[model samples]
Target: MAISAQAREILDIAVAASEAKLGINPVALEVTDRMPFTDVFLVVSAESPRQVNAIANEIVDELIKHGHKRAKMEGKDEASWILVDCRDVIVHVMLDEKREFYALERLWADAPEVPIEVTPR
Candidate 1:
């Protein structure tokens, strides 16, 4: 399944928001063919838990500002791995260590990547 235009819209908002907050190594995967729930998976990381939460919150705020409501949120308290389900896009903001451990990119290795064109904030 090709990623929808709305998924790209989410990428535009979420990736820029992530970059604005100094989130590192942001990667967008087109996962629609593999999963029915969402069209994209946006994976990013920060050096610390505080930064992880900051990135997660910023992404959610930015998307909501553009009228996108998150369907669900997880791992906010620990901030080691925060997942924000923004309808068509599910964003994973994690601590650097946790990101490396989970290796989501590798887990979804078959999913083709979608480039994020970033203009921070």
Candidate 2:
């Protein structure tokens, strides 16, 4: 399924922020078909808990700055896996180990991936 325009915008902004923080292997999945609540599921990985928190914070700040409010936030305390639900876009920031274990990409293999243009380092 194709992500809505609103979700595309959110994905763009979220990806930019995730990239800025060196968030690794960012994947944007159009989960509208499988999930009714959110249009897109953005999964990103960080090397450490601190990095995970930082990536999640960056996404939250970037979205809120643009007037996007999060409906709910989870896992900030542990920082192993943080989920930010912004209605249309849901961002997941997880530690490398946790991400590898969960394999969200494999779980949502049917969902169409939104290509992200990586900025040169």
Candidate 3:
């Protein structure tokens, strides 16, 4: 499915935010065809719980700063895996262990990835 321009833009913002927080193994999947509710899924992994929360916060903050409304964030308190629902773009900030265990990329292996160029930090 072709990702909408708005969704792509949001994905870019989320990727940049995640990368800024030193998120690892970032993957952006175009899931509009599979998931009718959202256009994209961006999965990022962090080393620690604190970093997980920080990346989630940064993504939400950056999206809001770009005139996008604040997202509905889940699992922030636990900090192992946080989901930031930015309407068309859903951001997943997970710890290294949880990311390896869950393997969202593998679960949605059929979904085509939205290629993003990450800036070196």
lDDT (10s digit) by residue, model 3, range 1-121: 6899999889999998998889998999989989989999999999999999999999999999999998999998899999999989999999999999999999999999989998765
**lDDT (CA) per prediction:** 0.88, 0.88, 0.92
Q: Where in model 2 is the C-alpha error above 4 Å?
A: none
Q: Say which candidate scores most in lDDT.
A: 3
Q: How accurate is candidate 2 locally (lDDT)?
A: 0.88
Instruction: Check candidate 3 and list the clashing pairs.
Output: none
Deviation in Å, model 1, residue 17 alpha carbon: 0.6
Cα lDDT tens digits, model 2, 24-63, are 9888888898898899889999999899988888888898
* Candidate 1 vs 3: which has more lDDT: 3
**Residue 57 shift from truth in candidate 2, angstroms:** 0.8
C-alpha RMSD for every candidate:
1.9, 1.2, 0.9
Clashing pairs in 2: none
- After the best TM-score superposition of candidate 2, give how far the Cα of residue 100 lies from its true spot, in angstroms: 0.6
30-96: candidate 1 lDDT, tens digit per residue: 9998888999999998999999988888888888899987547899888899999997999999888
